[model samples]
Target chain A: MPADVTALELAGLRKSYGGQAAVREVDLRLPRGALLTLLGPSGCGKSTLLRMIAGFVEPSGGDIRINGRSVLALRPERRPTAMVFQSYALFPHMTVFDNVAFGLRLRATPRVEIADKVRRALALVRMDAFEARFPSELSGGQQQRVALARCLVVEPEILLLDEPFGALDRHLREEMQVEMRKLQRQLGVTMVVVTHDQEEALVLSDYIAVMRAGAIEQFAEPIELFDRPTNRFVASFMGVSNLVDGIVERDGEVSFRFPGGARLPVVSDLPAGPATLALRPEAVRLCAPDDAACRLTGTVAFTSLVGSRMSCEIKVGETVVTALVPRHGSGPAIGERVGMALAAEQLQLFAR
Target chain B: MRGGAMPLLMLPMAVLMALFFGAFAVFGFVSFLQPASGMPGYQGPLGLSNYLRFLTDPAALAILGETIVFAIVVTLASILLGYPLAYIMARSPYRVVRSLLLGALVLTFLSGSINRAYGWLILLGRRGVVNDALLALGLVDRPVALVYNWTGVFIALLHFTLPYFALTVFGSIRSVPVQVEEAARDLGAGPLSTFFRITVPITVPAIISGAALVFSLAISAFAFPLLLGGGRVRLISNYIYDQLFVAFNLPFAAASSTIFLVVAIATLCAFFWLEGAVTRRRAAKRGAA
Candidate 1:
């Protein structure tokens, strides 16, 4: 319970099925009252890692410590952790009130205290009015709220959620993501969420661990992970559409040499060698062909409207670059020559 | 084409049902006639004398009451013995364990009923393996009366009905999502608590349905009691068989068959009603909460 001690820690945690490893040597230290998201694609071992922390799935190696004490030997029911499953596994035979009070009843809490705590937990999720309803009677979002209340009522030391909004529609999923973040801040409870959605992680997490295969690819804050991804995989996963393979040349000044003898000024600390430049579509501005700020010249091959932005695919010496510009006028026509001005600060360079 | 072909496809089943019900109707009509000492063994002048005789005969009424009580006991015993087996078969993590249990149950189902009855008699006879083991172990001073009475008949009947009960409940238990039980454990309930509170309650309807099936199967039992009862454990089916074959009184047999049919139908109706109430009360209990 000390402030300096981490709320949850995993040291060299691993899981393997037969010869194939599902999670390999994961180490994390989450401070108290902070939310961390394990973001990854399907089958990336995020769910398995979360299950290890919840004491549902036994780790193949290493230890999981909660409150600076090892909980590896404890059973799931004995551990001080609760999880909200993706399917919202609520007891169909029990009312919402009883579902929330189940853990308290197991602990032999007083009847009056159980009722009081269940009521407050339901209120926390804005589901106090549905105490008398069964889980089958509620909508998906409402059942999700009850599922959250059922876990929160137990006052676990660490809360875990496994793709909690995977069943909801888009608009509702976004709303619950924001609401979950707000509730976590208000309660100041340490939490871990597993999700395959990058946007959901960005909206809900204090720190995001983008995972690939069975390891953490990059772990950082939202802005840092999006703007300064450490590798090509992280860059692509963060929606960087343009990855131009080039070489860094330090002749006179730092410059990136493209494959077809085109050079563009860049700022990097890497020595002159092979590298890849990660450019976001929205970071490129379409301008007049003779503009002084133009960094590349190409002919537009295709144009399409994306909401309020126009996406243009420009062919630059056998390499196609996509630029997203505001849809004010008719935008660029196909086969029209144009200049692309890349934002210098937003450009990311990665060693190949 | 979809709707038109359905009825034509059902025509054979309709004819089969008509023949079955037609035979039952003839038997029911015979219950109202008077028995005569001749071929066909029936006369005109319809009356309820056969029914009145059965309603008044204390010995016959006693047999009916005893049969009902025995059926109830066997049904309750099957539930107790079969539920755990069904649970293991449905939820055991090991495929070998589940397959072994299911294979044994299915093997019992596939075997001939008379063959199984004779097998039980050989195993449970006075000088049979079970009694010999008990005597050799010095657990009993004498061989227990396991056959030729109520005990032998009860054991055989339970064995016969267990597969019906267990298989009926197995599919239901499998349908209860594994995550529901895990959610209970994640919420601080132990394994046993999760089973009783979450898994069992959710499968109540199936349990009742299985119990109903076993009850009806046990109540109308004719072969086990005939083979193992040693003329002592005569159930309703045995009584009807005696009246028809031994006594050659077709009208009386028809009357008793009608009564048995009515009782069986009533019991099945009650079970169905209880199943509905269990499901409805789950949703209705919300108001009280």
Candidate 2:
């Protein structure tokens, strides 16, 4: 079932170290059993925000609530949350069984009950027969699984993950991503993941919170955030986007121009004014020089083969515009003169 | 040639080793040839009498007991004091604090044995600053006699060994990855639990090595015990010194010194074995996982 519970809430949270603010005025609403990802570049406060939510960092101002109960004053151990770190911080001395049993042991749970719960948690992560193994004996992916199992054994109200797969190889990272999402769904526990990788966020998050210097840039559903970014940073950060500077003439007749002299027709209802425009590289198509409607002309400067697609950089105006063409029969050679037409709807204009 | 140079380097030490070995061998052979008979002079043929006399002597037994207790107490105290100082040194934010600690450590090694013992002697004496404060504060009615006893010797030993313990343990603590501690905290372990469960266990090898070194030094300590003990407490070193310098019984003293060497090696080997066992246990646990 979809989470009808409000799992966690942050109200105007702020944190500063010494005198410098690391996280400022951050507020969020996380649904119970939902996975929320905070995405941004390094030092953008995403990790800081996640740390605050996990209670590792005490917010200098504002409050946090878990399961509708205020947890602002609680210590990390007292808070009803657990964090999985990027380094897979499994205790090196303890066996997998003991590491998973640590939380239950801390709570003074019965030995038999602790054993049962650890066994079940390990099974959930599909790591059932590895109980006696120390963390050092496992591979990177196995260690990550052990870490996840350790966190889940606690059955906390929320699980906070700080780039849990950041240390894994690409293949293992992707596999863990799928496995983590499945586990989160199966157990119906809320999860908050922090990562700078936009693709990982898009793959795992129900809601993506894009953070910039000490503030949230935008927070919305993954599809909405990617398709309609609120600003240039989000647009460029989310994926490959071509930004063209231009001025709208009047009454939705928009013409987008690059740094050089080349211009392309764009669709916008913005009043006649200077503006910025954006288009995905895949949205533009290569055409013969004769087909000039809504077209920009330039010399094809460089070409790179990416899988089955070819990306060509065209010197349009004073800016280099890239277009990704499907590598079908034939395509333009480097230095070939080309005209690229942008689909009218694909070009988006905004006020500068 | 590399092989030729190897033998050249070994030759000097080898000759020295042979001479040292030859002296001990000759002493042993001579000790058996003539055994001590009356009030304490060799007069007869080879027998087990010399060995039996030394092992059964009450004074010899007391020295052995005192040496073991001293080694254990000094080793324990060094580890207790050094672990916290090492932790602080490894994590202190200010470079000046680290430099000050390092400066203090260097000062520990600055003075000769007599000078360092004298410093300890003054502080621990009944009329010294420590007892003066105790009486002035009414913590005691009279100045307590702390010097010229085992307590005085222990204080001196602790002073001599603490800096070495700190320096060695500091290197080990520094190598403990900060990420490990952060991971523990993130996993909901409190600060104290994380420290004991993670940081302390990982550095056990260093602690064992440091303890073994301190124990060896404490057992063999001569100047500190001789100066501070002031004829009250007799350690193995003092006993050996009296046997050699006062009694001039080279064979008996050699036998006692050889026993001390064997005990030291045994203590070191025991600690190394314990550390190896713990490591193997951890590795086996990982394999099971």
Candidate 3:
């Protein structure tokens, strides 16, 4: 209950559907006013976790504490939380004002107070002008904003959104993501968002909980997750990354030896054995061949022009290593031999 | 899309009006004819004697009152039983249960209403299964009079009306997005309050349409009411029948049928208009609120 404590905490949170676990040992401590993104692919238990927090899905085992108090026994409405559903869930019969005022009305708030709160919440989401319009009349972005207003009007301790902007177009999605992030900061309300888009997660969340196979793979700041992913799944799942199979040789110098005999010296305490060495596309520097601790010479097999970067796939013996270089820079053409330098700091060693 | 076909489309409309409503139009015209009492057809020098007799006859008036009361009560009773059953069928979590309920409904529908009414007659008759069970259970000392009265007719009619009520209510409730109701609960509405605030308000159109259907069917019901009501309970349709075949007065029967048709049409129109107006008013109120 302390002011510095987390707004929400899950201790050994688990959910099973007929003996198969949907969420496994989900332990999280979401700080007050912090926006945490439950980042994962579909069926990775992010939505299930969010629903458990919302009390829509009861945990098979564990404690869900909101504001440092256990709320597993409370119904969704009794909990100090509100959710912005993936479908927006706006009542078809109600106007924008009524939809936004839905939560307040349930609380038996006075007419004048409800009106004021609804207006303020709508204005917070920049949807004040659309009060008289029905949800069917609004665009996707407008409806999402109204959904947010509906949650905000309730003044819940935390706000949960499941793929909050999944229904919007690419342009509108990006715009709403930024706008919602700003609103979260402005309101200083704790939020837990579920999304599979890593870039959106990075841009919107203060911390990202990368989930896979019904368990949290890593829960850390977005920058840390991008740079120092705890496992190969996180490293490869985040974006384009080269996971070359190799064995660590820790004699005299720690170096990775691929099955094809290509060597890249790595710094790791992992015992000498087979491993998957992770290197980001951005971290693989293209350089002239020379005697270096972490360098490999390979021929570029393909080059894909992606935004302002040319992502080239290089073949080093039987392994294809992907690397990103700026588009404007001089780089190896397809079938050209090139020397690739791997940064040791960026090398993620995952033991088999 | 085909602006030029507007007049051509009226061809079907004209044909339908001529084939169907044309009979009623003829009846309306005949209702104004003066006829000798108890005559099979009018010996006319056009007058309003038939219509006036229909309006002033005591037996006809009683039958009219009986028909209206029967229809209203049947509509309400059907709704009370139907809404909950429909709600269950619509929201049943198990697909098997939903399918079974729907299958039973369709099977019942495939069987003619008259056959079903007769089935109900067998079940509710004094010497039938229901009364026998009641007697065996010591719930009744002797067989009670269920048939040959309004109660028998009502029960028989309800058996047919329930299916309409269920199907319409089920469709209307099913059309409401499940997420909307979940959203209501998430917003702190209890189950009952959520039903009143979200489910019921949204399904009003279906309720009104279903009620109108049941009401119209009940009022014009002929065979079931005649079979069950026997000689005690006479409805407008029975009276119309008596005037036609029993008394052999075609002009008076035609006049009475015309009045019944007009009233049924008027009731349907008023209900629909009321539904539309209420929807608009709700929209306006919510917008202003």
Per-candidate interface DockQ score: 0.79, 0.49, 0.63
Candidate with top TM-score is 3
Give the candidate number with the greatest lDDT: 1
Whichever of 1 and 2 has more lDDT, that candidate is 1
i-RMS of candidate 2: 2.6
DockQ of 1: 0.79
Predict model 1's lDDT versus the native. 0.92
Q: List TM-scores for all candidates, in order.
A: 0.93, 0.90, 0.94
Rank all candidate structures by their lDDT, best first, as comma-separated numbers. 1, 3, 2
The reply for model 1, stretches above 4 Å from the true place, is: A1-5, A250-252, A287-292, A333-337, B1-18, B37-40, B132-142
DockQ, cand. 2: 0.49
Q: How do the residues B82-152 of candidate 1 rate in per-residue lDDT, one tens digit apiece?
A: 99999999999999999999999999988988998999989999989999999999999999999999999
Distance from true location, Cα of A259 in model 3, Å: 3.6
> Second chain only: TM-score per model?
0.95, 0.89, 0.92
Between 1 and 3, whose DockQ is larger? 1
